[model samples]
Target: MDWGLVGILLLMGAGGGFAAGLLGIGGGMVLVPFITMIFTAKGFPPQVVVHMAIATSLATIMFTSLSSVRAHHKHGAVQWRIVALLAPGIVVGSWIGPWIGKQMNTSALSLLFAAFVTFSALQMILNKKPAPGRELPGTPGMFAAGGVIGVVAGLVGAGGGFISVPFMTWCNVRIHQAVATSAALGFPIALSGTLSNIYFGWSEPGLPQYSLGFIYTPALAVIVAASVTMAPLGARTAHKMDVVSLKRAFAVVLFGLAAYMFYHAFA
Candidate 1:
């Protein structure tokens, strides 16, 4: 292992996990872009770099979600009912996401990732609220929403919070509950996306050593270790801090990340 890369991954995990806690994003929104930069700078091939970055970033969510949810649950912030209603669709949609990714080339995947990140940034910056009397839909509608969330999240390596939080809040869920619930939802997203990406990329060539399909194991291990340590702290901070300014600052950072991904798409 390159010790230097490991140190950087550690820092990435610390930042990603905190973001996951603060933003309920499962760290993927932060991890994907940074991992791509790391891999790209090392001269990795585009196919392996983009796919592995997404896969490894997603794999870390399994641990971060658990840590984050524990903190949220301690505060009675998780909405379990909604999690149950959304899960079946999420699993099915997540299973298909990596297959769709497999069919796309490096450029297309990069562009898609960029678009998703840009949308997320804009959504954060806008911070719109839903109309009064707007409520969560019926079971069928929840499933449909879950399907869309799962597919997009799996494709982009997010925890689905970018979409799910606003959605839950729009339906009149409390912000704290929405964040907690989104953290809980991360487990399912991570499990299905990680498995599917592994399966889809299993036979691909040119992957580096210490890799499991698309996941770079060293990065995954270090990131998970570091992220898990920070997620709970982030969760605690969420309940105690007023983060409006922080959110805007983070949104600005996301725009920069999106720009990098866009440049990468055509590079």
Candidate 2:
């Protein structure tokens, strides 16, 4: 194990986790690109590096999501009903996501990730509101929406907060409630997505040492350690300040990450 690399991963985890807690995301959006760069620097196979990064990102989220949710729940902000309604469809969609991802080549997946990140960033920057008096969908509609969120989140290793928060807020949920609920939703998204990635990549060739399927266990361990510890802090911070400005700042960061991914995709 390279201690230096481990240090870098720890730093990445801290940053990602803080962002996750603050934003109600699972931190996968921050972890994926940085982990990819790390793996690439270590000369992991280009074809599999992105997959490994995403898988590990999801794995880390399993812990970070739990930590964030615990903090949010303490504040009584989580909407358990919404989580229950969305989980089933999320599981199904997450299960299918890795299979579809595995079918694509590295460049394609990178481009897709870039596009997704760019869209999320733009949405944040625009801060658009739904038409007046818009409400959340019915149970069946929510299920379908969950499925879409799951598929896209699984493919990109995100916790689905970007979609879920907006959806909830549009339906008249308070911003705090929406953010907290999104944190709750991250659990199923990360769990199902991580399992799918592991199953999909179990027999793939050219994996790095210390990897289980597409997840690099060493990095996962280091990242989880840092991220879990920092997530609560982020949740606390989110409760204390104006998150709207933070969201815009986060959008700028996402745009930079999108550009990074785009560069890597076509390089």
Candidate 3:
């Protein structure tokens, strides 16, 4: 592997992982576009470049989520009950997402991803709270919500935190608990999504070397190494910082990324 490529991957991973821990995100919002650009520069076929970037981002999330969850768990912030309720539907929905994504046009998928990112960023900027008396739904409702979160996350290669955290908070869960629980949910989302991507793309042609299905293994390896190490530090930072301000700052960054992605889709 080119050392320069490795360096870039490591940098992306570190940034993504830190965001994951700090914002209760899986970091795919950051990873997907950057990785797509890197793969494009490497001359990968445009049709498959986004797919590969999403797949690799999901794969990396498996590790980053684990690391972030561990940190959250240490603080007794994770709500395991919610995770248990969400896992079944999340797995099924995640499995189906890649199959659907594989049939979409590359530019369409990129635009969709950009839109999702922009929406999530706006949510952070607004920081809206739900009704004071709201509460979590029963098992069936939680499962359905998980399904929606999983499908969207799988398509975007995210950890589902953007959706999950908000959903939990709307149900009157505390912000820290919602964030922690969302970190735990990332495990199932990433795992199921990665597996589906691997299966769906197993027969695709023109994938780059060192790839396993849609996942680019070299980038995955380098990114995972840096991300896992940095996740705990981010979690620690999250505990100490003013998350609301941090989120607004992150929203500005997301807006920039969204603009870039929009240009890429149309230009």
Candidate 4:
């Protein structure tokens, strides 16, 4: 067995799970760049490296979502009604996203993911407060927003929190509540991304051994084991810290991740 690889994956999962709980990001944002690095370093097929990283990251989020959301739900922060209304649209959107993604080459996908991460990080840095009179949108508007979020999440293999949390806050939802609700949203996003990646990648050649469609099962098992343990701890910390400050710090990290991916794409 490759102990070094196992160690790296374990560490990745732990960090990703913590981020999922703390930022309601479902851990994909944290996992994607590093997983890309791992796949590239291992000499995986150039055409499939980005796709595999994204697909695997989304798969990990499936576990982290449940673990983190459970913790958030206990704090009474999740908005179930909002989750219900948004989910249907999210599901439909997610189905479309992978098809769109498959049309792009690895370089294009990586560059796009870099762009997505950078945009999200900038929003945190700006910290734009909403107008007091703003409120959650009507059902139609909410559904439309959910579709957009889902599509983007599936495209980049993220949890949709980057867009969802900010959108909720812009609609005057409290930050804590928005975070929790975003965590809840991770489920559908992860589910769709996972399934779609699998479907899209199923027939691709040169997949590494132990792969399930686009997912590397060995890494998936190890990452899920570690992430599930750390998620609740991160959730507890989220409640105690100055969340805005934490978010700003995380944004800086996102910037670095984005830069690296940009380089990977262009260079």
Q: Which of the numbered candidates is closest to the native, going by highest TM-score?
A: 3
- Ordered by TM-score, highest first, the candidates read 3, 1, 2, 4
- Tens-place lDDT digits, model 3, residues 101-201: 99987898889899999998998899875654778899899889999999999999999888898789888889888888988999999999999999999
Task: Please identify model 3 stretches exceeding 4 Å from their true place.
Answer: none
**How well is each residue in 58-140 modelled by candidate 1, as lDDT tens digits?**
88998999999999999999999999999888887777787788888887888999898888888778876554357889999
State the C-alpha lDDT per candidate: 0.88, 0.88, 0.90, 0.88
Q: Candidate 2 residues 21-105, lDDT tens each?
A: 8888788878889988988888999998888898899888889989988999999999999899888889888878878999988
Best by lDDT: 3
Expressed as tens digits, the lDDT of each residue in 1-267 for candidate 4 is: 399999999999999999899888888878999999998999999888988898898888889989999999999999999999899889878877877888899999999999989988887788765654678788898889989998998888889988898788878788899999998899998898788888888998989999988888888899999999998898889888887877788899999999999998986
Clash pairs detected, candidate 4: none
For model 3, state the Cα shift of residue 217 in Å.
0.5
Looking at model 4, residue 131 earns an lDDT score of 56
How good is model 4 by TM-score?
0.95
Span of 10 residues, lowest total lDDT, candidate 1? 125-134
The CA-based lDDT of model 1 is what?
Answer: 0.88
